[model samples]
Target: MQKKNQLLLVVLCLILFGTLNGFGQKNQKNNENTNLKTSPKLVVGIVVDQMRYDYLTRFWNHFDEGGFKRLVNEGFNCKNNHFNYAPTSTGPGHTSVYTGAAPATHGVIGNNWYDKEAGISVYCASDDRYTSVGTASEAGKMSPHRMNVTTITDELRLHTQMRGKTVAVALKDRGAVLPGGHTANAAYWFHGADEGDWITSTYYMQELPKWVNDFNASDAVEKYKKPWNTAKVINTYLESGSDNNTYEGLFETEKTPTFPHSTPNLLDKKKDFEIIKYTPYGNRITTDFALAAIEGEDLGKDEATDFLAISYSSTDYIGHKFGVNSKEVQDTYIQLDVDLQNLLNTLDRKVGKDEYTVFLTADHGAIDVPAYLSDQKIPAGYFVYDSIKPKFNAFLQYKFGTANVVKNFSNYQFFLDHKVIKNMDIEVAKVQETIANELLNYKGIDRVYTGHQMMQNNYTKGIPYILQNGYNQKRSGDVLVVLKPGVISYPRTGSTHGSPQIYDTHVPLLFYGKGIRKGSMVNRTEIPDIAPTIATLLGIAFPNGTTGEPIAEVLE
Candidate 1:
């Protein structure tokens, strides 16, 4: 009996010892995790308007080591990244990035689409019901009310019970409003020239914050008046076409599309700050405002994460004015590269080097000048919608006995008048079919799909799939049109984007700073994947209408 008792005591001691040892290992693992941050203190989303993926490659040698190169080398690059929907324009592109859904779900079909109920074309961000808060002018009369769903920023705010704040800044109204989402603390846009100021709508606040007022009052914008010039010698711009070419559009008062052009000459007697949109100075001022917002808003100052959405709108205006292959366009990008370097350096000082995450992308990519492509034996041409619209209306009148049945036409979509069709005793589906068939017979028209087809069928690939992704049942037009490859509805000079083609859909997607994997991915990725990746990193719920899955390789 004494021997058995001694054996039982030894077994109990051994079991107790094993239990303590297991807990010791578990406690040590928990201690190590204290040093590993699950989320960054802040997130900076940079959307460069009209930036193409090829710009990173073509301007690589010209880029500074600290800017685009740093983001690509020290961070992760989605090389085959693209916007997943058709009609890749500014409003829809920005909406898709933050919403984690396509325009079909978000309800921003185009920058300006025909509003059948409103009986007029509606701008994506324009909301006349809201008053201007920061400016007396109508420039601030805009909000993100058109978006039908939540964004990643909105989800962040909800996850923290409104402890997380978001501030959005851009040169264009839609640029600021859409990315800021519905729950943002502030969304500001620059309205310049005579005023030389930033503005916001009443949707976020009743008045501009004191810091924004002080920043606007300062002479910061005066520094950018130093004439627009090339960052390097003119001869170094060999990647672009000739300095003087017919493909590029000229300034109002200028004759050539060359650089070193007077910034003042571009502006008239009113000294309208509007010309700034066409210059690299616009990007500099936008960065300045964004930095001000960071300090004024006290972003990244606490444990809760904050968000800053900065959109470089000048790049889009410049790309539209100078086309893709011009010395002016090349110089703007180089200057933009420098501005981005300054921004990153500031982030390091204001927010710790590893405390913030950055994602740089573009709203959309522009196509090369169609005329220029034609000269190179490329199969490209212009589809003049203005001239063709009148003739198409006449054709509709001949077939349907009334042109009034077509209520509106924009974004290559045809909106029919249901009331008029009902009065004419015509079936709406029949009208859609007739219009779709007629559009297909037109030159430069590749394919046309009726809204009925999109509602009844699920397209898995090709242009039909993209159009379906962009189609909204209540807001979209009855008939959707697709242009042939390399065809654009634009002037001979300059460039435009609003296509499912790779040139417009392809844009840069770079991830940097904390919680980002340092590598490059040649595998395909889409714009909608951005918000979900951000949601995954933040350990928060994805946007309410999210249709995209997070890229598994993008996070650390």
Candidate 2:
């Protein structure tokens, strides 16, 4: 009887130990798979603001091996990628790049849009409810609420249950806000003062992290106090047009268009800091801040995918001030190549080479200055804003018996006060048609279609050039105004985007590092397709409202 009882106790002990051992092994396997499923240790998204597709080759000779060369030689380069929408501004560019949806779907149509509901112009990143954490004004009160769709960064956070870190740094607020997505760990943008060091709102965190405070307090601005100067020889930049030309706009303190800028004291003044937006160093500062964020956040450290979005804002500034063809633009690219090399080197040291993924692309490209194009007899000319608006107003008065039919005209978008039309009992659709017809008569105007007409028309054959790209009904204007060939909307110093021309739409898309293929795709791909591609690469869910498919060549 004693032997039987002892045998029963031994059997029970054996079963309990076996059960516990099985559970432990299963848990260990789960933890291992969880680490594997977390995706790349780091995903770095580098967006060069206003970077043209051709510039990559144009400045290729000057690039260091580890920077742009590493991306081109080692990564999968999408040669013919482009933004597939009109009004390709900075805000929409960043939003689309990160979200993998165009302005039509993302809801960030322009940097500052005339909100039909509010009846007031709303900045893309502005949120009145959020107070600035770094600055006094609401300038820092920005968020991604306006962005309707999820970004790749948002997906990374979601997949990790918000354990992974995501940080976006740029010189511009919209550049930072849109790419950081709704649930970013932190988004920092330069405000251009010793005190204005990268500001953010409480939306991300209540207080600045200790690392960020230390970085800000370091007084890095003192480095630029030694007088701004060109990093390369002027003559070596033979690819660009002559400096100090009539086409190029003058810098604030520097009289000539050439470099060796001696305006360090200008740093103390707000107006001078505004000029910093036009120089290449603005991008350097942006890169510096990005590196700081990466180190401070300890991104990609644990079992969560991390993302760091860095946008080089100087290209847009240089494009605006010097035009696309100026030596300034050329030099900026050359300098940027070196800066990119440094950034990549830092990434190699910080985030192991095969462990992280990097994708580099542009927001939008810029047109050659209209003045330069006209000089070259290329038929390019500035849009006659003064002539067109008054004519439209006169036509409106004739049709509706009032001059206030058009409320605002900017970025080729004409917003009509529907309230006034309703009160006056005027036919809004008829008025829009009349304005469209009149606009078509102008020299620089090509074709004009009412928003209703574009929505209904499926016959793309011989459709207007501007309407060739995808257009979403919700974000576009009441009347889609198409500009004639070789016509730009910029009236000020230099060139502008927003046209459906190849110059504004064509941009580079290169993917390098872990899991990326080493080949090129010349087939034309839209910008919205980028998000879906990233989602597939990381095995994350597709962003809502995405109609794009991942590039089949790059995927495994």
Candidate 3:
């Protein structure tokens, strides 16, 4: 009897130990599940339009401690970030940054491209199916339907079952629309009419929200119409070359391109509210609108992650009007630094300090004014599109014994009239090769690629690779043209970006906040990497047609 009792007690002890071990295992599993579900409250993608990579270093000393300086000291900075495709215009830049795909896959080749089917040029975001929601103007008929693939924001919304909110704000419509994706909660851009109101399209909603209406009624543009002057004294902007250069474009009101000018004349005479976009005040207005969006939508206040895309378009406008080496450009950067500081401060207070993620980059970087380069004795010249198009048409006609064979010559590419060519029984490939060979002989032309070659995926490395990434057979032109280094096809007065040169392709890229490390990486990264990096942090699948790899250095 004693032996039996001892054995029974041992069996009960073993049973109790097994139960405790099972409970521990279940607890551990639950903790692992919780860890996998964790994510930041908000993700902010800031695109400073036309920002060059050197701007951070160029303006480092002038930057405030809490603004650009803070980001550099406490965030992961990709010092050598670059755009991977050619035709680095606003539309393609914004679309590529969020889609993780190039223009070839995303179908936004440039700001505007000649549509063969429509037999006319088509704007990147223009959709005739939708009407304006906030204003009577056609500016509101914008949507992201042209984008072929899903964006990072779209993936986030899908992951959360449409619970996540995505909002975009900018001074330009394409800057806001492309990054907001198709299923965004709302996308807003400054309309600059009847006292400057924010507008949207029927693609997102049938009517403007009550908050937007109230904000528009506030007459925000009236506040920015003050006597404009430099942020710091004129001489302090030493790196900008000179203050009054003939290369800069003057405003409608000002005689010379100097500062301390007032905008009351702009509003008083022409009622030109559009003038404000050319100044730093445009950046301020965009920031205010973004803050309103965050508060109004209650973004980042819930468990699911939200996205807010802000593109400061005034920089591009200012850069275009005033050359990169002008006092106006320098002053604009200084003022933008303050605006950035205020924005980060607000984000810290609204969404807890480390609960949000932010990345600041640019749509594209601008080239130095060709005139400025000429003065510096650099071999730079303006390749006049007007002069080239007529010659290209004549050349095509000479080859095919028909007039109007070249339908369009824009965006450094030629569009052949395929319908006319077929009727004339002209082989498209032969015409493309002929144009390519002839275009190469043109002055300031570096190399030319035929549409047939691109369509067949027969391209060499380097610039050809970039052209291939930007080429969409249906949307792009029939013959691709690349200009020599430092050559621009736009106005000689200021600067523009479209080439695959280092200056146009290079841009600033910095990442901060949740899941980010306080370090810098010198790795070569491209615009498409931005989307995949965000997706990786959120533990979501990459955008559908993603061709970019995740920036591993930024991931936690």
Candidate 4:
């Protein structure tokens, strides 16, 4: 009886020991998979306006070691990165980047859209509730209220219980506001020649900080008035076409769009500060503001991870004034490379090398000059909606016996007068179809997707799929228009981009610094992958509306 009792005791002891050992192993595995021991001190997101993936390659030989080359050689390069949706404008692109969602979910269809409910046009970041906090201009009336979903910045703020700071700076309001997300500590944008200062809306703070006030007090804009010249020899710009092309727009101060133009010549008498943005010096001032924010805000000093979002808007302005393949555009990029190097050096000193993570990308890429394409015998041309809108209204008037049925036409979308249609007892779907069919008859228009069709299958494939991803029920138009590849709706000179083609979709994405692997990824990746990758690195939940999967290879 004693031996049997001892055997039972031994069995019970063994069982208990096995159970506790198993529990310990399980907890250890959980900790290893999650709860990463450390995160980067700061996350710097640099967005260059109108940057195409090819730019990095086209100007590869000219780039320095610390600028684009440092990010490409020492960092992870996403060679196949692209924007996933159509109508890739500044507002939608920036919102999509930080939200990890498309415009359909983020509610930023374009830079500007016709509001059916308000019966007027609405700016993407404009809000009447918020007034300017730093300046006494109408510029303060902008906020991120239009954003329908949370961004990665918002996720960081929530995870850290609002301890982590998020700040953004840009030359344009939308460029600054959209990427900072809703919970940013401050989002600053350039206020123009009159104020010549970095300004923020009341949505951020009741007043500007002392550092910002002092920075604004400095005559930064005036300092760049010396003159604009090429960083390299004029003949070395072989990648770009000859200067003085018809595709380039001349500045107010110059007779020809040539080299060595005076910066003061470009400044408006009343709004001389506006000329700063037209030159590459605008990017310099923007970089200075970002550096100031870093020091003034103590971005990387704390235990919690912070984010500094910077967007260089001069590229877009320069691209719009001069075609993609001009000496001016080439020179702007060359100068921009130096500016990037300067910012990186500042980060190295302030945040420490490898202490922060940096991701450089673009809001949207631009298409080549339409006139240049035509000169090359390519099937490219401009589609002027001004002419087509009047004709379409006449067609609708003839068919429905009514005039002014089209309320608005912009962003390749049509806004019909719903109130008038309802009052006249006209079938909304039929009218939409009629307009879509009429639009198909116009030149450079590839296809048209009516609202009803989008609702049917959610446009799950092909061009319609791209259109649907950009459409929002409350904000989008009744019909979506797709242009033929290489065609635009802008003037004969300069260039623009708002298409689903490779020219507008393909953009450069480079991830550098902490928790990132060094190498190149050839696999196709979209813009939405960025925010989730950052979240994964931080060991935090992805942004609330994230539809993108983290690139497992990028995380350490």
TM-scores of the models, in the order given: 0.94, 0.90, 0.93, 0.94
The TM-score measured for candidate 2 stands at 0.90
* Candidate 2 residue 51 C-alpha distance from true site, Å: 0.2
Candidate 4 per-residue lDDT, tens place, 1-556, comes to 9999999999999999999999999999887655454688899999999999999999888889999999999899999998888798999999999999898878899999888888888899999998987777788799999999999989988988999999999999999898889899999999885678899998999899999998988877678876788889989889999887788898885788888877775564456688788789999999889999999999999888999999999999999889888887888888889998999999999999978999999989998898899899988888887777677768888987886677888888888888888988978888899888888899899998888777677555567777888878778888888899888988877868999888998999999999899999899888989999999889888888888789877776
Candidate 1 ranges with C-alpha deviation above 4 Å:
1-36
Q: For every model in order, what is the number of clashing pairs?
A: 2, 0, 0, 2
- Model 2, span 39-139: residue lDDT tens: 67888898999999999988888777877888899888899988877777898888888887766577888888777776778888998778888778666
Where does model 3 exceed 4 Å of error?
Answer: 1-37, 389-391, 458-460
- Model 1 residue pairs with clashes: 193-272, 193-273
Displacement of the residue 556 alpha carbon in candidate 2, Å:
3.7
Best by lDDT: 1
Candidate 1: residue 138 Cα off by (Å): 0.9
Candidate 1 per-residue lDDT over residues 247-335, each given as its tens digit? 98887777787767777865655588888888999999998999888899999989889999999999999899889998888888898
Write out the backbone clash pairs for model 2.
none
RMSD of 3: 4.3
lDDT of 3 at 204: 94
State in Å the error of residue 46, model 2.
1.0
